[model samples]
Target: MSDLDSSTPLRSAVLHRDTHFIPKKAIGGKGSYIFLEDGTKFLDSTGGAAVSCLGHGHEGVQQAIKDQLDQISYCHSAFFGTNVTEELAQLLVDSTGGKLSKLFVVSSGSEAVEAALKLARQYFLELPAPQPDRTRFIARLPSYHGTTLGALGVGGHVMRRQPFEPLLAKNTSHVSPCYAYRGKKDGESDAEYVARLAAELDAEFQRVGPETVCAFIAEPVVGAALGCVPAVPGYFPAMKAVCKKYGALFILDEIMSGMGRCGTLHAWEQEDVVPDIQTIGKGLGGGYAPVSGILINDFIVETLDKGTGMFRHGQTYQGHPISCAAALAVQKVIKEESLLENVRNMGAYLEQQLRQHLGDHPYVGDIRGKGLFWGIEFVKDKTTKEPFDTKTRLSSLIQEKALQPEYAISLYGNPGTMDGVRGDHVILAPPYIVSKEEIDIIVDVTVKVLDEVFKGL
Candidate 1:
């Protein structure tokens, strides 16, 4: 076996995502860069999957965590609530202008999604007439929610679901995502494309017996699975209308796109519709602590309050003190520093730079995103929009090359941008504090790496 092969067990005890290649150890980080154990500094262009919004080693967030630790670190959320947790929850709700009335905190994006699924189910059960029959969920294809079974079942990422197909819930169904670059027909207008997508969703509801579906979940700006593909205009409202027509709840999974990663604090803010249940994370705690949660609309909260008066979900670390404190501090810093504005300004510059430099490249098929989150889809034939064969492993090559000492940069690369097994794209989600100069550096290095990788093709 090759040294990089997992068949040859590594010295480390931790089972990594890829046992074949042990990743560099991050010893420390500050601002937009991370320092490896061997003293190499790499620019954090993708914020570790768009998690670190405020960059790293911020004193304000660290102090908040330390303060919470000094008072109390752990507490059973069921019996007692920390002041910090309450404040954080209130802050999140208030940010939504009281539209979403309640918050249920958790430790990660997966947990938040799991809670969303359960809460969505329970919301139906808590309704005036009750919907015990509403056991199914509808989500978009080429999407991801989380790794847990319930979240995974609702998610439509084919490769992720393949191994656990037998174990996944049979109640979940998937329809086409509003991926305009590919999904939109050649002669269709944006409005027509959205209408067609809405019709597809409406048909999916009918196929699944809409009455049996509890919710329709999607990312306002599709992340990870499809490489930051936002829906065409009017897409969300049309889909939400269909869900309303079916009496199903509309859920938005914003674990990667929200929390000001997409200019607005909530990605839905840019959309015309509001989700009944919205899951948020990543940028919430800015990588200072593990934190994620669900924001519930007033209707759902009131329904439950009038019925069971409980969500009937529990986690040991729900509303964790330190996590809440760290998240609270992160939000405060964003507000104090006006980082959202920076995200908008810097995002525009990044988009302009990327398009100006890489837009016309023969291999660049599509570049789409909003705010600071952007993606570049690579193609073997630009005219045909033909993606490189999966065997090429183009995304992996770009990621590997970008991380070399000469490049000293980090990027989020993924295969299967076209479907579950084809296409490649790389995401650029620099921290909100990233400067124009840093963006130029990112674009320059990105060009170099892509050129180097594609030249041999």
Candidate 2:
């Protein structure tokens, strides 16, 4: 629409996620907006899948990366450790108040989840009285952990897992997610719903043999798969209780919901539970670098400390110095700028604005989320809560329309919100530095886009 004509054919050597539709190239950005190569400026509402907490170009993070490059760029985790890496790890551990005692850095959320799964299994083997039979993992249905084989194995997003079923691990089983919007029955209270979901988890543990389980993995605030669904009150504590009863580790995948995205340093903090293993990414490095990591509780670390004295896992870029430096600087900026406070204030305003603007739309089924992360689910009939047919691809259409020159906004949209196949929802996770005015723009644009899309249908 700007520099490149839409009718022009485009070709590239890089294998894209969607081969049929090549995305617009982003040339540069700064502070809550991205500039496309075609000279279009877009409001980054979803923060590039909720990764850019500090937004596009922050001088502090850039300087940190440059300073690290000036010193050392790469060092094998086994052979040598850098001061920046240690500082980043200590900063993360200290943020958790030492409850989660160790951090294992990696390159992405999927890698962090992959590490979590393996570490859960190894933790059992490292026990004084080993429980090698504890080889199974239990995750919740309609949840997403990551995309790699092992991470994909434990995730329950039906559509994502369908094609890779044969290759996925057979040991992982799925239980009911604490998704109250669809899962809660009529007349059921929050406590009742949580109890029911917890019981379902316990039953799954019994069915799979509790003694054979390695961990019960779930997202404190379910991401992508459920569109920013936060667990009902007492949900995590109840689930953690079941895990404790079965002597299985409790793992929280906070890849998209942690690092102050949900108005807390850790989502589990609000849930009144602390996971034995927690995988975090997205906001960890604020998209300044490709970085993610898992935090381990003292018990898990102590077990390995006394037994194997090693994690027995290695990656070529486990603790890249530049990545660590970038993340450290991002964290400091978030703290010094008091951005978490902005996340809370702006988040509340966002929720109010979303509900006020779209809550009563006939096709809009549910408006939900916490802090800066929110989602709007669409349905054919709000009264019956019936989803539109998958053939319509409503979410994709909304996302595509929002990216047009008129709207010029970016949103995270996905289908299968109900069962990973039938429902549609779009998420809005603006940068932590976003303001009420920016939130207004995001909501105003979202309203126009939704109105235009649904009106056509």
TM-score on alpha carbons, each prediction = 0.98, 0.98
> Which lDDT tens digits does candidate 1 get at residues 1-457?
1125556558777787776767778889999999887778889999999999999889888988998899999989878988998899899999999999999999999999999989999988988898899999999888999999988889998888899999988988889999988988989999999888889989998998988999999999888898989888898999999999999999999999999999999999986478999999999998899999999999988998999899899999999999999999999999999999999999999999999999999999999999999999999899899999888999988998898878988779998889977999999999999998999999999999988988867
Report, for every candidate in turn, its global Cα lDDT versus the true structure. 0.91, 0.91
Residue pairs in collision within model 1: none
TM-score of 2: 0.98
* Each candidate's clash count: 0, 1
Per-residue lDDT of model 2, residues 1-457, tens digit only: 2233546565766666765557778999999999998778899999989999999999879998999999999988889999999999999999998899999999999999999999999999998999999999999888888999999989999999999999988999998888888889999999999888888888999998999999999988887998989988888889989999989999999999999999988988885598999999999999989999999999999899999899988899998998899889999998999998999999999999999989898898988898899988999998899999999999999998999988999879999899988999999999999988999999999999999998888
**Candidate 1: worst-modelled 10 consecutive residues by lDDT:** 1-10
Model 2 has an lDDT value of 0.91
